[model samples]
Target: MVLVSYILAPTLAFCNSYGTGLTDWNLSSTYGKIGLFIIASLVGSDGGVMAGLAACGVMMSIVSTAADLMQDFKIGYLTLSSAKSMFVSQLMGTAMGCVIAPLTFWLFWTAFEVGSPDSPYKAPYAVIYREMAILGIEGFLELPKHCLALYCGFFVGALLVNLLRDVTPKKISQFIPIPMVMAVPFYIGAYFTIDMFVGTVILFIWERINRKDAEDYAGAIASGLICGDGIWTIPSAILLIFRINPPICMYFGPSASS
Candidate 1:
């Protein structure tokens, strides 16, 4: 029902910002937790967490597939491509991700001490989901077991966000700190936030300088950047296999690349 609601009314997905603020993470994660709650209620506690995890997986897959379908439809409209061919291409890419994802994970898991202080990618979202599952099983009183201080912080933050949003004008609301932006450091740490800040600064400057051109080309530019980053990862992984670290990493201490 939640999935259908989002499909029919896309704005409903964004409405989560006003609630528990889980939508800040992403639409899929937010809805997955909803599914988790429902599944837990039906299955009872013993297997509820596992059931919730399964529900999260299914919800994410469905939401993501729907999102991808929409994007393909847009591209098909522009290029006049056949819908059948687009569907086949999407399936082929999905199959490739199934194969490549595990091997890529294995490469990183074997190469670095995952979840350690030194690791580059800490898998922060995985930790958040795990904690959410625990919370679903145990409820509010058990908050301290996970991290009571963090939970309290989130609660206070959400309250402030709601209050601020209420008083702020709609025209200026875009300038207000989004609940998701404030919640970032709690989930993924400050480094990712720093990266985001850099990107935001760049966007701010671009929009200020040439608002029209930025509006016109931003979509194409962003798409190219995403694809370029993904393409670069292949070579980066190959370099790792050959024990060749990045040039910048060589300047740092021995453990920097790890």
Candidate 2:
């Protein structure tokens, strides 16, 4: 399977990146994951589930990497920046993320066994992936009873979306609730969703108050905030690694007395 994937990976990456660059849409990463899942399932016949999972991981990594590079190039084109510089920066960022991500995870896992009953971080995405893999390999019976309602809701939501687009005025349609926004809350827990809500509210308020310069500076401000958030993680991880307690840390769990 590795040999076959190696032979075909370049073509796969090219197709994924080409579509992403042309459309500026993010379907490539998703479609690549699906393609890898299918290929892995086929490979499972000979090498079992682990082989298939490994293949999917490899393909997903390749496809996502290619897609990221293409998207960065697209951004560079729009911004009149050098594609070579963007590529170099992306490579550096990716390398650092590969190293730091695991270490950060280890820090968190040591601090709190995430997804455990006592842990605040429930890892909803990991649970979804595990469920998806189980359903894919073990058939629909492995799915929960609520999945039936979910399937029905999906079709109902699709129909409603079409109805909304048809009946609502174009200007009003733009303000209508997006299905993705509505659906995401079901996938993620409240803590993350609260952040999303807060960010959306902040953006809305910013647009209302700074209508004149919003278009010019809003993106830069948001970008700065995002970069700051990410940059702060380095110091956070260092503090965790060195066992340096902060001045204040929120203890969301049981009290020490309890």
- In candidate 2, which residue pairs clash? none
Best by the lDDT measure: 2
In model 1, residue pairs whose N, Cα or C atoms come closer than 3 Å (at least 3 residues apart or on different chains), thus clashing, are none
Best by TM-score: 2
Model 1: CA > 4 A from native: 1-34, 37-43, 46-50, 65-156, 159-163, 170-174, 184-191, 226-258
TM-scores of the models, in the order given: 0.48, 0.49
Q: What lDDT does the true structure give each of the candidates?
A: 0.63, 0.65
Q: What TM-score would candidate 2 get against the native? A: 0.49
Give lDDT tens digits, candidate 1, residues 19-100: 2232123345656676665555455568766776777766665556555655675567556799999989888988998899
lDDT of 1: 0.63
TM-score of 1: 0.48
Mind giving the per-residue lDDT tens digits that candidate 2 earns over 107-129?
Answer: 99899879976679987755664
- Provide the lDDT at 183 for model 1: 61
